[model samples]
Target: MTFVSFLRKNLQKEIFQVKGDKLIHVLPLAKIDKREAANYLCVSVSSTNDVYITLLNVMEEKTVLKCETRHNWLLKDLKLIDGIDQLQDNAEFCLHFDTKIFNLEAYSTASKYAFLRCLRKMSSKYLQYELQWIHFDQDFVGKSHSLLVPDDAVLSMQICLEAFTCACLCSCF
Candidate 1:
């Protein structure tokens, strides 16, 4: 059998597959450091070819790593969003790594939040930031008053608005 077929067949087995939620994120492994013993199976199978896998099982409270290399990081080490760019939100939100990491395209708003919720569960409490969308009853002087941002970010905006209001009131006299 071809390597592709062999991999497909093996991946279907229960040993390789774990039961849990669908992947919240699937970041690629830039460097796959494999043991010399791992090379015994086939000459064609190189460390570079193997796509390392990291499974985030939120319900089970574990992150499983099936990397090309033997060494793997547990949930605690992996889940902390300490890096400044660990999470990015634009048209889409991505967790961990800026480049070459897998894209988690959450089509619906609910799905996006579900994914974020799962991510928050996996992350450290301080590092976790919930995503929220804000909507005002009406636009402010025709300017759009709708926004979607992290919960922590809203605090600063609120403070700035309060300061602006106070300054305006003081100046009015």
Candidate 2:
């Protein structure tokens, strides 16, 4: 099966299970200003080992927002007021993406801790490599290394490596 289909099937099966109920909460982070209304924040792990956070409309049982922790995603704790006059009592943490941000609030302290632990655990599994380096050893020169390299330098190095790999492959044939 295609990856999308597999993900959807796994999400449907895991998100509706009895254990998934614990992850459901009325998160006030919804676009609607009605804090009293019930909205669901659901976190689930797909069969493919991907982590997903979904915001649901409890009344309609429909997803309002869904995010996967694969690309350009960050989870942070909203501890400080950061000059805001007041913060919501339930406002405990937030999930940040490249284009969107979700302020997450839990039903209780324990729930907040649990969610944080789960998110952190999942997020830590994916590591984005910022730079690549190649090492050469010789008798005259033991080893050489580059330090404090800029982003452009790293990109150039990666491009050079790719070009070298392509050249070697072409020469072999």
**Leading candidate by lDDT:** 2
Estimate candidate 1's RMSD in Å.
16.9
Q: RMSD for each model, in Å, please?
A: 16.9, 20.1
Provide the lDDT at 104 for model 1: 36
Per-residue lDDT over 70-157 for candidate 2, one digit per residue giving the tens place of the 0 to 100 score: 3221122222211111222233555545456455555543334334434444455532221111121111111114447532344346
Task: Give the TM-score of each candidate.
Answer: 0.25, 0.37
lDDT, residue 78, model 2: 20
lDDT of 2: 0.39
Task: Tell me the whole-model lDDT of each prediction, alpha carbons only.
Answer: 0.32, 0.39
Worst 10 residues of 1 by lDDT: 37-46
Going through the candidates in the order shown, the clash numbers are 0, 0
- Compose the digit string of candidate 1's lDDT tens values, residues 101-168: 33333333222433343344434233344322222111111222335753223434554787899999
Q: What TM-score does prediction 1 earn?
A: 0.25
